[model samples]
Target: MFEKVDPQYLLEGVDGFIQEEVSYNLFYLITGFEEALTIKSCDSKVLFAQSPRGNPWLWVNRDLPEEERENALKLLIEYLDETPLTGVSSEPRTAEMFANLYGARYHTSIKRRMDMEAYACPQVVKPEGVSGCLRSAQLGDVETVAQYLAGFSEDGYGIVVDPASQMEAAEIMVCKGGLYMWLVDDRPVSMAQIAHRSPRHGRINAVFTPRNERRKGYAGAVVSGLCSILLGEGLVPMLYADMVNPASNRAYQKIGFIQSGQISDIRFE
Candidate 1:
């Protein structure tokens, strides 16, 4: 049976599993939004969270028998909704299974497959740039960061988001010293951010270089530098890249990131 649980209680129950797979679930659990909804089986074999922003996520123990997975998913569906979810994301196998069942019941489609990768700070070839340096984004850089974040959302996920909303998010990152920018001759050329860090895993995301700066290797430089800093702190750096974007996937690989696994972002339309 599935029952809703408090976030703290849920986190304690899944601590062991999440620490091992921290790269995947840290962002969802650490968002600090108390309204985030979590549900799991009585035996704690299956866990799901509906983020405060309405994103559904699932983590089912792979060791469970196939029949158990199906039953768990059925209970999740009943607790969440009888109708289709607007969007869902999870590991590739779970995503495919959930999408199949969701599509079987409603008119929905698989939106995208996001590949998650990790880097062990393997040697990186720093891009040839004599005038630029990576620096933490400051309050003065809020406007630029917001604009870049908006562009990133549009180009990466094809989602049009308000500049104000993006600014609000960027402000938080900047205040936390998590956002960084690559500056050339005192002008920002590219941006990246460290996000959702656990004790051992730190995620690099929101890597964006404006269209005019494309093909300049600024993004690679910024991300490589970020990885170096994260490694100095003794954390494994990881990030998600859109599978459809060959350039990004190639860029990240060149900087020593390897494909760890694939995940999916399914949208109901």
Candidate 2:
């Protein structure tokens, strides 16, 4: 049987598991969201969380017998009876299973949105010949950061967002001191942000290089430099790469990030 549980309950006994399967960091981080809801099986072998701002996420203990796992998923679907969900994200197989069942019950269509790979870096291999230094993004850099943010959205998702639309986010990130820029001769060339920090890992995201700055090793250099900083703080650096973006994935691998696992994002229409 599955029942609603406190979000904090989702973290208990899962620290080591999350450390090993870094892909589930989404599950770890979502619990902190203000409107997050969590549910787990009676034995706590299967877990699910929903965030008001994003798709629901599920995590089933992989060591369970296949039959047991399937049964738990079925119970979870029943437990969620009329609760509305637009999509689900989880390990590929689990997300597929839940999406299939959820769609069948709601008579909705299921679509795979994105195939994402989680990577963790144990070391940093700074790109050679990249003549840039990594520095914190300042308030004065908000406009540049906004442009890069807009470019990242367009390149990563094919969504043409106006740079002005990203100004507030750029200002907030800069004020948070988590955004970093790679500067060459005092000109910003690339950018990345330490999006979140968990117990033992720091998540990196929003990595971007302007179109004119591509092929100059700025992206790799900035990420490598950020990874070094995270490592110095005793946290492993991790990020998710869209499988369709081979260039970005290659750049990350070149800097010593190893593929830890895959997660599927599935939408119900």
Candidate 3:
């Protein structure tokens, strides 16, 4: 039923879950390259809803009636009820009670939204015998950057993948930016993005450093550089740190990032 988001995007999330051979160039109507909530309705109906800081998040877009959206939700739930699922936005506080908001009912029981940010910059933390440089990422750097992301750990956020996660993961990374900087040998040790649709918002993403390269200031420098890039573009950068990783959060605070509020989400049958 999906008509807009490239089917390839939808399949990537699916591949992440099924861990099977994924075919490309497939577009989905509602679900795109990111994971879509997989639900096979046994008892309760499920919904997949989307929210954006703005319009450009959707590459090719369309709109449907509120009732149509609701029906789509009901159908999607019925279609994929057996699968574990997730949504990608900060849930509204009153989300659970609403029958329908954007395109789906607010599922209060679903897991809370993972951290999304406007932009974030960590305070300066000087590292001895180290130097860092930041700049926008380019096509030439994709292989190197991909290698770094391939090794990034969710650090305890429950996001993990084997060697198989490469394709879909890579596709999502491409939508990001050609503007990322690397530290030391011009390899991207940390990478983030300033949102295109929102002038005041930025997102820190794919901030990875090789395991052998951890504890150095490369991460901070790369993120700080990305923040400066966003600022230069006249935007404020925002990002989320794992509540569990006090060190990561603290590093950001040292570099001038502040916590506005915690984001929570949920789902229901």
Candidate 4:
């Protein structure tokens, strides 16, 4: 059995479970889900949370016995009958199990993803002649950030996203002091964002360097700088990377990130 609960309440109930494999959804739950929705199993062993009208993700406690997971999945299906869900992001086993039992057609096959965390700052080597410093992105950088965000989506995920929407998101990030950039002669060359942050953890994401800036070490420099700052704030830096992208994964590893575990991103058509 499951019961609908306020997201604020769910946050307290699942705090320990989310730490098992902290991800964007976790940060969003903590930092941005004031108006979101939540549900938990009657035993409080499983949780499902989502942004308003957005896709919901599952988070099951590792200690929850196998039988509990089975029962929770059934309850989750019944709950979904009333609340539409377009996707699920969770540990590979949990997400796959839910998708199969829910009869949600596999819209996109599961992709292998790595969850990584950094304990110490990485030693970064700046390319010769690439001189600049890292700084928080200002509101004036919206155009540049928006363009790079769109390019990143296309290049990194092979998905086309609306530039307007990207700009809106970039504006929010800049205002929140979440966006950072590497500039040369006052011109932005590479950028990264603190995607989701908790008091003890911060996730680096949306890393991008223009094609002309590629291989010049800007991406590495910006990410390394961000990780160092997050560490200074007493927060462990973490990030997620597609296992298919060796270069991206290698870049993060070079910044002292070690593989923690794997998760799955599945979309239902």
Best by lDDT: 2
Winner of 2 and 3 under TM-score: 2
**Total backbone clashes of model 4?**
0
Give the higher-lDDT candidate: 1 or 4: 1
The sequence of per-residue lDDT tens digits that candidate 4 reaches over residues 1-269 is 78877766775656456556454335354336677767778776787877776657677877878887877887788766766667777777888788777654324443433322322233333334557889899989998898898888888768888777798877877898878999988999999988766656777888899888887778888888888787777777777777667787777776677676566767665
Q: Order candidates by TM-score, high to low.
A: 2, 4, 1, 3
Task: Give lDDT per model, in order.
Answer: 0.75, 0.87, 0.45, 0.72
Q: Can you rank all candidates by lDDT, best first?
A: 2, 1, 4, 3
> What lDDT tens digits, residue by residue, belong to model 3 across residues 17-92?
2211111011122243244322222221222334222111111111334465355545554443454344323223
Identify the candidate with maximal TM-score: 2
Regions more than 4 Å wrong, model 4? 13-21, 24-32, 104-130, 161-166
Model 2: residues with Cα > 4 Å off, grouped in runs? 14-16
lDDT of 2 by residue, 87-115 (tens): 99988988888888878778988754899
Preferred candidate (lDDT higher): 2 or 4? 2
Give the runs in model 1 whose Cα sits over 4 Å from its true position. Answer: 11-23, 27-32, 82-84, 103-131, 159-172
Worst 10 residues of 4 by lDDT: 113-122
- True lDDT of residue 113, candidate 4: 34
